[model samples]
Target: MTKEFLLECERKLAKSYVCTALGRDDDSIAITKEIAKDIAFEVTNSIHPISMETAPYVVAALRTLANGIEKEMNPLDKEIARALQELMGRFQFVKEEVKVDL
Candidate 1:
Protein backbone atom coordinates (compact mmCIF):
# COMPACT_ATOMS: atom_id res chain seq x y z
CA MET A 1 0.00 0.00 0.00
CA THR A 2 0.95 3.63 -0.18
CA LYS A 3 3.41 4.90 2.39
CA GLU A 4 0.89 7.43 3.75
CA PHE A 5 -1.72 4.76 4.26
CA LEU A 6 0.78 2.48 5.93
CA LEU A 7 1.96 5.26 8.16
CA GLU A 8 -1.59 6.10 9.18
CA CYS A 9 -2.28 2.46 9.93
CA GLU A 10 0.80 2.42 12.10
CA ARG A 11 -0.29 5.55 13.93
CA LYS A 12 -3.73 4.13 14.65
CA LEU A 13 -2.24 0.85 15.81
CA ALA A 14 0.13 2.73 18.06
CA LYS A 15 -2.85 3.99 20.03
CA SER A 16 -3.40 0.42 21.15
CA TYR A 17 0.01 0.50 22.77
CA VAL A 18 -1.07 3.51 24.77
CA CYS A 19 -4.41 1.98 25.73
CA THR A 20 -2.95 -1.34 26.86
CA ALA A 21 -0.44 0.48 29.02
CA LEU A 22 -3.15 2.35 30.88
CA GLY A 23 -5.27 1.22 33.81
CA ARG A 24 -8.46 -0.68 33.03
CA ASP A 25 -11.53 1.50 32.52
CA ASP A 26 -14.03 2.71 29.94
CA ASP A 27 -12.40 6.14 29.88
CA SER A 28 -9.04 4.77 28.90
CA ILE A 29 -10.53 2.66 26.13
CA ALA A 30 -12.62 5.54 24.83
CA ILE A 31 -9.65 7.83 24.63
CA THR A 32 -7.62 5.23 22.83
CA LYS A 33 -10.37 4.58 20.31
CA GLU A 34 -10.80 8.28 19.59
CA ILE A 35 -7.13 8.77 19.00
CA ALA A 36 -6.90 5.72 16.82
CA LYS A 37 -9.88 6.64 14.68
CA ASP A 38 -8.56 10.12 14.09
CA ILE A 39 -5.17 8.81 13.17
CA ALA A 40 -6.69 6.30 10.79
CA PHE A 41 -8.63 9.07 9.04
CA GLU A 42 -5.54 11.19 8.64
CA VAL A 43 -3.62 8.28 7.23
CA THR A 44 -6.30 7.38 4.74
CA ASN A 45 -6.58 10.97 3.60
CA SER A 46 -2.87 11.08 2.86
CA ILE A 47 -3.03 8.27 0.35
CA HIS A 48 -2.77 9.00 -3.40
CA PRO A 49 -3.35 7.03 -6.57
CA ILE A 50 -0.83 4.26 -6.30
CA SER A 51 -0.70 0.50 -6.74
CA MET A 52 0.17 -1.15 -3.44
CA GLU A 53 1.33 -4.70 -2.82
CA THR A 54 2.29 -5.23 0.77
CA ALA A 55 -0.48 -5.44 3.27
CA PRO A 56 -0.31 -3.23 6.29
CA TYR A 57 1.72 -4.74 9.14
CA VAL A 58 0.86 -2.36 11.96
CA VAL A 59 -2.29 -4.16 13.06
CA ALA A 60 -0.53 -7.49 13.21
CA ALA A 61 2.24 -6.06 15.30
CA LEU A 62 -0.31 -4.35 17.53
CA ARG A 63 -2.18 -7.60 17.89
CA THR A 64 1.00 -9.33 19.01
CA LEU A 65 1.90 -6.49 21.33
CA ALA A 66 -1.61 -6.39 22.73
CA ASN A 67 -1.46 -10.08 23.48
CA GLY A 68 1.80 -9.57 25.30
CA ILE A 69 0.35 -6.64 27.21
CA GLU A 70 -2.74 -8.59 28.17
CA LYS A 71 -0.53 -11.22 29.74
CA GLU A 72 1.28 -8.67 31.85
CA MET A 73 -1.38 -6.00 32.37
CA ASN A 74 -2.62 -7.81 35.46
CA PRO A 75 -4.71 -10.86 34.82
CA LEU A 76 -7.34 -9.37 37.07
CA ASP A 77 -7.72 -6.38 34.78
CA LYS A 78 -10.45 -7.69 32.55
CA GLU A 79 -11.22 -4.18 31.42
CA ILE A 80 -7.79 -3.86 29.91
CA ALA A 81 -8.17 -7.03 27.89
CA ARG A 82 -11.64 -6.06 26.82
CA ALA A 83 -10.43 -2.69 25.69
CA LEU A 84 -7.56 -4.18 23.80
CA GLN A 85 -9.89 -6.63 22.15
CA GLU A 86 -12.07 -3.76 20.96
CA LEU A 87 -9.06 -2.00 19.51
CA MET A 88 -7.81 -5.17 17.86
CA GLY A 89 -11.19 -5.81 16.28
CA ARG A 90 -11.27 -2.33 14.78
CA PHE A 91 -7.67 -2.60 13.66
CA GLN A 92 -8.35 -5.88 11.95
CA PHE A 93 -11.38 -4.46 10.22
CA VAL A 94 -9.37 -1.58 8.84
CA LYS A 95 -6.58 -3.88 7.76
CA GLU A 96 -9.09 -5.98 5.87
CA GLU A 97 -10.52 -2.93 4.16
CA VAL A 98 -7.09 -1.81 3.04
CA LYS A 99 -6.34 -5.26 1.74
CA VAL A 100 -9.58 -5.37 -0.18
CA ASP A 101 -8.78 -2.06 -1.81
CA LEU A 102 -5.44 -3.42 -2.92
Candidate 2:
Protein backbone atom coordinates (compact mmCIF):
# COMPACT_ATOMS: atom_id res chain seq x y z
CA MET A 1 0.00 0.00 0.00
CA THR A 2 1.08 3.55 -0.65
CA LYS A 3 2.02 5.89 2.18
CA GLU A 4 -1.21 7.85 1.78
CA PHE A 5 -3.31 4.71 1.88
CA LEU A 6 -1.70 3.45 5.06
CA LEU A 7 -2.06 6.88 6.62
CA GLU A 8 -5.73 6.96 5.74
CA CYS A 9 -6.26 3.59 7.33
CA GLU A 10 -4.57 4.78 10.51
CA ARG A 11 -6.78 7.86 10.56
CA LYS A 12 -9.93 5.82 10.22
CA LEU A 13 -8.78 3.43 12.93
CA ALA A 14 -8.10 6.37 15.20
CA LYS A 15 -11.65 7.59 14.70
CA SER A 16 -12.97 4.15 15.44
CA TYR A 17 -10.89 4.08 18.59
CA VAL A 18 -12.56 7.27 19.79
CA CYS A 19 -16.00 5.98 18.90
CA THR A 20 -15.40 2.81 20.82
CA ALA A 21 -14.12 4.76 23.79
CA LEU A 22 -17.35 6.77 23.80
CA GLY A 23 -19.40 3.56 23.67
CA ARG A 24 -20.45 4.14 20.09
CA ASP A 25 -20.12 0.52 19.13
CA ASP A 26 -22.29 0.88 16.05
CA ASP A 27 -20.26 3.73 14.68
CA SER A 28 -17.01 2.03 15.56
CA ILE A 29 -18.12 -1.11 13.79
CA ALA A 30 -18.98 0.84 10.66
CA ILE A 31 -15.64 2.60 10.56
CA THR A 32 -13.74 -0.62 11.21
CA LYS A 33 -15.54 -2.38 8.41
CA GLU A 34 -14.55 0.39 6.05
CA ILE A 35 -10.86 -0.48 6.53
CA ALA A 36 -11.18 -4.17 7.11
CA LYS A 37 -9.09 -4.76 4.03
CA ASP A 38 -6.15 -2.77 5.33
CA ILE A 39 -6.46 -4.41 8.71
CA ALA A 40 -6.35 -7.83 7.07
CA PHE A 41 -3.52 -6.95 4.73
CA GLU A 42 -0.19 -8.66 5.36
CA VAL A 43 1.75 -5.96 7.15
CA THR A 44 4.98 -6.73 8.94
CA ASN A 45 7.71 -4.58 10.33
CA SER A 46 10.19 -6.06 7.86
CA ILE A 47 7.83 -5.60 4.90
CA HIS A 48 5.62 -2.65 5.86
CA PRO A 49 8.23 -1.12 8.21
CA ILE A 50 5.72 0.71 10.38
CA SER A 51 6.50 -1.02 13.65
CA MET A 52 8.85 1.63 15.00
CA GLU A 53 6.56 4.53 14.09
CA THR A 54 2.93 3.60 13.49
CA ALA A 55 2.67 0.20 15.12
CA PRO A 56 2.35 1.45 18.68
CA TYR A 57 -0.45 3.83 17.82
CA VAL A 58 -2.26 1.22 15.77
CA VAL A 59 -1.91 -1.42 18.46
CA ALA A 60 -3.12 1.01 21.10
CA ALA A 61 -6.11 1.93 18.99
CA LEU A 62 -6.96 -1.69 18.38
CA ARG A 63 -6.57 -2.45 22.06
CA THR A 64 -8.84 0.41 22.99
CA LEU A 65 -11.41 -0.63 20.41
CA ALA A 66 -11.20 -4.23 21.56
CA ASN A 67 -11.50 -3.41 25.26
CA GLY A 68 -14.15 -0.70 24.99
CA ILE A 69 -16.81 -2.95 23.57
CA GLU A 70 -19.73 -3.82 25.83
CA LYS A 71 -19.91 -7.08 27.68
CA GLU A 72 -22.72 -8.50 25.61
CA MET A 73 -21.57 -9.98 22.34
CA ASN A 74 -22.46 -7.78 19.42
CA PRO A 75 -21.63 -10.11 16.56
CA LEU A 76 -20.11 -7.45 14.38
CA ASP A 77 -18.20 -5.81 17.20
CA LYS A 78 -16.85 -9.18 18.27
CA GLU A 79 -15.62 -9.95 14.79
CA ILE A 80 -14.08 -6.54 14.31
CA ALA A 81 -12.27 -6.75 17.61
CA ARG A 82 -11.05 -10.21 16.75
CA ALA A 83 -9.69 -9.06 13.43
CA LEU A 84 -8.06 -6.01 15.00
CA GLN A 85 -6.40 -8.14 17.63
CA GLU A 86 -5.04 -10.33 14.89
CA LEU A 87 -3.83 -7.30 12.99
CA MET A 88 -2.04 -6.10 16.08
CA GLY A 89 0.15 -9.18 15.93
CA ARG A 90 1.10 -8.44 12.34
CA PHE A 91 2.99 -5.31 13.33
CA GLN A 92 6.02 -6.83 14.97
CA PHE A 93 6.70 -4.73 18.05
CA VAL A 94 10.12 -3.20 18.25
CA LYS A 95 12.16 -4.05 21.31
CA GLU A 96 15.10 -2.00 22.37
CA GLU A 97 18.03 -3.63 24.04
CA VAL A 98 19.29 -1.86 27.09
CA LYS A 99 22.83 -1.95 28.33
CA VAL A 100 23.89 -1.28 31.90
CA ASP A 101 27.48 -0.51 32.80
CA LEU A 102 27.09 -0.74 36.51
Best by TM-score: 2
- Candidate 1 lDDT over 1-102, as tens digits, reads 468766766675566566667754565556567665665556445442223443345446556865886777765676855755567556632323333342
Superposition error at 41 for model 2 (Å): 9.1
**What are the lDDT scores of the predictions, listed in order?**
0.57, 0.68
Off by over 4 Å in 2: 38-102
- Model 2 lDDT per residue over 10-94, tens place: 9999999999999999998888766864545534322443445665786787568547754566889787667766755555445
Worst 10 residues of 1 by lDDT: 93-102
User: How high a TM-score does candidate 2 get?
Assistant: 0.39
Q: Give the TM-score of candidate 1.
A: 0.31
Alpha-carbon RMSD to native, per candidate:
9.4, 11.6
lDDT score of residue 67 within candidate 2: 70
* Model 1 regions lying over 4 Å from their true place: 1-24, 48-102
